[model samples]
Target: MTAAFVAGVGMTKFEKPGKREWDYPDMARESGTAALADAGLEYGQVEAAYVGYVYGDSTAGQRAVYELGLTGIPVVNVNNNCSTGSTALYLATQAVRSGQVDVALALGFEKMLPGALAAGYEDRESPLLRHLLALAELEEFAMPAAPYMFGAAGREHMRRFGSTPEQFARIAEKNHRHSAANPYAQFQDIYSLEQIQAAPMIYDPLTKLQCSPPSEGSAAAIVVSERFLDANGLRDRAVEIVGQSMVTDLASTFEAKSAITLVGADMSATAARQVYAQAGITPDQIDVIELHDCFSTNELLTYEALGLCEEGQGSTLVDADATTFGGQVVVNPSGGLISKGHPLGATGLAQCAELTWQLRGTAGDRQVQGATLALQHNIGLGGAAVVTAYRPAS
Candidate 1:
């Protein structure tokens, strides 16, 4: 297979919904131009483009790319809910790896409404109705399905492994502390565990600070075949895509009647297993990670799903400070969705940008020391989870 590498990446600062007067196209232009400049390439060099956004019309990709140039290259629009960004990245990588395109651009941007996520299409059949039905069978449905699903998962973890809400609070606290060093983060203000726990509750055991807010942002990356990299003298600056996998809901999602299963934990584990096997490395080898932390609960559940710790023992990792700087692994050095903000469509590519910067040793104060290997996990319930591993080109 042809190897693909990320030659350049850029992202606009994640902002609260309506915080900026700009629109999605404006954000996309800023990030896309920055990425091209970073790669020292022009729009014409890109053979194809994959754009991801959740709340946009059919041709949002074309409109956004038009800001960069009128090259008339293939511009594919993509939407995979919260995983949309990474899904776009996955498609671009595959296109390059298949020798279908020597150079491709993967871009993601979002201009979300201010509040918790809600179903966009109500009149038509809801895609998540089945998942919601399964949840209703196990526990009463909570409004704003996101926090409810993940919070239920947290409650299950507590019941099974004796994990405390305070431990979950610690996860939020740690991510906020990490975000303090990240200029691009949406919420960089530091918070103590007490403050996190005491914040207004959004869902049971999930405080407002612990939940990723509705955000607006854009991110872009230039992916190239090794041949293209060599031709352009970009090998020294490229970050190689070592392994990647995307998994969706399995039968266990509904059959288990477990909050963890319903929230896509099994899918995450499967995707991580695939990535580790393909890369010939385990979770222990990853120096940095940016997993889906739409809420602190999911972050804890993901610790076990990603093999960072044993199942049901995510709190132990938090208690030991193992998932922070100077520990077992520096998880979410970019502050994650919780503190950095989660702009559904932009999230996955934002993770791509952060990991790319980390591998290149260019993440300023948020840099993870000696970060040679990085892992990213992005998921969209209803549902899909994409896990990818990256390393600096040798």
Candidate 2:
């Protein structure tokens, strides 16, 4: 199939919600309007919509479209845990690529209230819900609430790979410093390595400073078919989506063998390899990346899993400043989930938005020089992983 191109992207400043103000739909509409404006298109130009949310209720997509004065666009709601935004974008990209639609919109929005965790799972009358909630609570107390699941995985990583808590803290420090330069990042405050290591421990070796905060935000992207772009005289500046892949791993904790092994490795690697082949590039050819870093160790594991570095060498890469902005490979110039704030559904599209800016050479202070190739990675609950590769207009 022909690749779809991202015509435009938009995002709101990540921040904590106030007592009363615009909610999820409001944020969604704002982002969507901005995206459409960026694409030099109108609301009517959008042929279909994929709205992603983790906790927002039914018709949330319709509500956002209503606010935008858009009607009758087939709005499909999607929830793929943390990967919701990217997953939605994947669907929209498919629609445009398959000749099903010429123009499509992918959007993600989230309004997080304090202590609101696990709100997306089903109602809690079932024993399984209770058990999961209990484990979640324990995990929350043990690690950063946002990367709770990864806490268990982190521990396992330490057990098998001798990865230290200090290594994870260093990852937090790096991203925190990166976030300080990002105006849209929720936490622009910088933290020193010492400060991060000294912060209150949420999970063993995982400190409160290492965790991502729940925030309110939205992100939207306008994707157009090559045909649509050609017809609209936009083919010259469009960023082609060269590769897209999503993979799922076993969800049960008992079934998981090792954190380092990434049960979904076959699927994720297969997807990555396919995208690389389609793009006529390899992992080394990627100049910039936006990977899911809900936790510091998660980023470390991704370094190896994504083939950015060798196995168990993620710490060395972090220590060498290889993943920092302007480094050999710039990862998460948007401050990443660690500092940028992971608004669940908004995160995946937000990653794409960041990449779009990087590729267009408009990322400002956080920009990587001559970033011709970029990658975006997102993982959902139960090991669902999505990877996408992009290249600037040739």
Instruction: Put down candidate 2 lDDT per residue, 229-300, tens digits, no spaces.
Output: 888887666689998888765333323344333423444555677777777888888899998888787888
lDDT of 2: 0.80
lDDT at residue 269 of model 1 (Cα atoms): 96
Kindly give the number of clashing pairs for every candidate: 0, 3
TM-score quality measure for candidate 2: 0.91
RMSD of 2: 3.1
The C-alpha stretches of model 1 lying farther than 4 A from their native spots are none
- List, residue by residue over 40-110, the lDDT tens digit for candidate 1: 99999999999999999999999998999998899999999899999999999999999999999999999
Q: Whole-model Cα lDDT per candidate?
A: 0.93, 0.80
Per-residue error for 298 in candidate 2, Å, reads: 0.4
After superposing all C-alphas onto the true structure, candidate 1 shows an RMSD in angstroms of 0.8
**Alpha-carbon RMSD to native, per candidate:** 0.8, 3.1
Return the TM-score for each candidate structure.
Answer: 0.99, 0.91
